[model samples]
Target: MNKLLSYISLSAIVLLTAGCSDDEPKSEHKGLTGYVIEANYEKKALLVAESDKTAKVGNYDAEWYSLNDDAILHDSKNNTVLLTDIEVGSEVETWSTSRSFESYPSKTDLSKLVVADDVKHPDSPMLQKKAIQAALSHAKSISDTAAILIVQNVTTSKSEWIIQVFNSYSEKSYEFTVNAVTGEVKQIK
Candidate 1:
């Protein structure tokens, strides 16, 4: 009877220890810093870019992402912002968990978006798909493994498209900028 009791206790301890394992994956989240290149309150989604000019996360992947209506959005001063308040070119920091980095664009949905009043926004006109079509056409040769790619549009002093590509295996990202009206590929900073 004592041996049986000891065995059961050992089993319980082992199970408890296993449940407390640190090796298990936890919710490791990253904050993505970028600007809101597109905002559609009707759709309750916004495209954010971590790099003002290109997809330059370097060795680290771009952690920035999209924000739906469910996400908590607040201004830099902590004032709450609804989907209708978001504007293009507004500097935004969003929180994201899992992201697909295997393509040129890092596609993700963030939990939160922090917007500041100081972020300048541009009056974006109705989107034209030509630039994105041009970008997607150019990206085919750059990557084939990508399942999701991030796309952002800007219309400030210069109209351009920012395409972010991600590759998880190589940990590589490709970013491109194309003139919106001209559909000409240019060097992205």
Candidate 2:
């Protein structure tokens, strides 16, 4: 009886497979294909849709707002794509096109960005890199990184070089004073 049941199940699976459509189009898209290059959350739309026609990320014509709400779709090479499911740092391969790098943070115009009132620019790139590395290192060690920001360089009367750290990402802005010369972190606010 068991042998008979196994044969019957196998036959059912074979029938199901044979009944499936094999000539259906590979992608769900009917028009415009590209890998999602960039999504602009602020704009409520995609910033760039990467297609073979454009090498660099550029504005391209894609189907937008087809459904009940304003939605975006793209065809990289020739296949339809969705941007939300894509990981921020992962390569994506679609039937049409292939993405070499992962998605990155959006670009901002320096002139428009609201810098902190107390932000101090370092004298040189070397000092800036050093200060940033020190601040990142200190934040990493504290295990409370979500509450930190790399602020301007601070100099005390005792000649101790310090860097200001802010926790603006959290509920309240907390500040930490890091010794720039010695990489010492001191909780200030």
Candidate 3:
């Protein structure tokens, strides 16, 4: 009879412990998916458009998310990448803080950003690489120690890659606008 009671008590304790176990799987929060309309490497921010449906977290609408200092960015293959590796047309999934400011292009603190798909856009690394090479070649004439400051896509009447190179030693700066589609150096100033 004592063994039976002991067995019953042990079973009850086991059941209770198992029910409250911290090892239980928690519900995963799915991140909002969007397309990157613009990526500002200098600001460490991304302007994203909702891929399908409007995404709302709390009272804020998600439009753009600035990368938190600890935010981790990953590519499609799960390889860690920099902001420059994420192109303007790339599809990305982002997890951000619960609260966001109510503004045009509501901003939030990005916790994690993962590239779902990288569509080959004119501003992509492959195209930008050519543009950078051209810009660097021109910058070399001014100063061999010239370094790139900003490389961004600008769309006005025509889409172009704007590369800004600076030579701190000479205090000289050059802005190069390259044809996005053709990867040709269109203008240097």
Candidate 4:
């Protein structure tokens, strides 16, 4: 009986191990969009953080990406550009696929970084100061007391504005999508 149990356990382990093999075909890989926190111009690499509320956006979940020397840089309109043109605070959407392993912060091969320009500052404190004002005006339920959180992950590989409004009195939070280029309110939640 002991021998039989050992055999079954071993078989189970083997099957499980085989199931998790990287040899298995994977689905289509996806791109990651986020702002650059640090750019190692010396190493020709970039430390990109995942863009999301759960992600630190600009600060955390930083992954070191090896940029191909031949990699092309693009402008907001997807025009081919130079490497030196890219800036640290700029947002990027990578075309390369992510690695399979469960590495720290995860890593990916960078094909290119998507750089989109923000034309409107209505939601921005410095550029528009009107961003919050626009958000408040757009959101009927959100009052002056509500706090606004801006996240730029409204779409893929592009930097769009997300106006998140939180009201302590009502104990509710609202999210709104604003066009980074147009400064228009796209959606309200």
TM-score of each: 0.45, 0.27, 0.44, 0.44
lDDT of each: 0.57, 0.35, 0.61, 0.56
Question: Which regions in candidate 3 have their CA more than 4 angstroms from the true location?
Answer: 1-31, 53-62, 119-189
Q: How many backbone clashes does candidate 2 have?
A: 9
lDDT of 1 by residue, 24-46 (tens): 86363656666554556665666
Candidate 4 minimal-lDDT segment of 10 residues: 148-157
Please list the residue runs of candidate 4 whose C-alpha ends up more than 4 Å from where it truly belongs after superposition: 1-28, 53-61, 97-101, 123-189
Q: Please, what are the lDDT tens digits per residue for candidate 3 over residues 41-156?
A: 89888876552233342121236678878788998788999888877656678887546677746677788889865323444444444555566565565565633222233232
Off by over 4 Å in 2: 1-105, 108-128, 143-156
- lDDT per residue (tens digit) for residues 1-189 in model 2: 999999999999998987896855433322223322233444433322223343233233322211213233333343444445332111222222212232222221111111112223343222333444455456546655443232323344232335443333442333455454565656565
**lDDT assessment of candidate 3:** 0.61
Clashing pairs in 3: none
The C-alpha local distance difference test score for the whole of candidate 4 amounts to 0.56
lDDT order, best first, reads 3, 1, 4, 2
Candidate 2, residue 46: how far the Cα is off, in Å: 21
The total number of steric clashes, by the backbone 3 Å criterion, in model 3 comes to 0
After superposing all C-alphas onto the true structure, candidate 3 shows an RMSD in angstroms of 11.5
Please give the lDDT score at residue 41 for candidate 3. 87
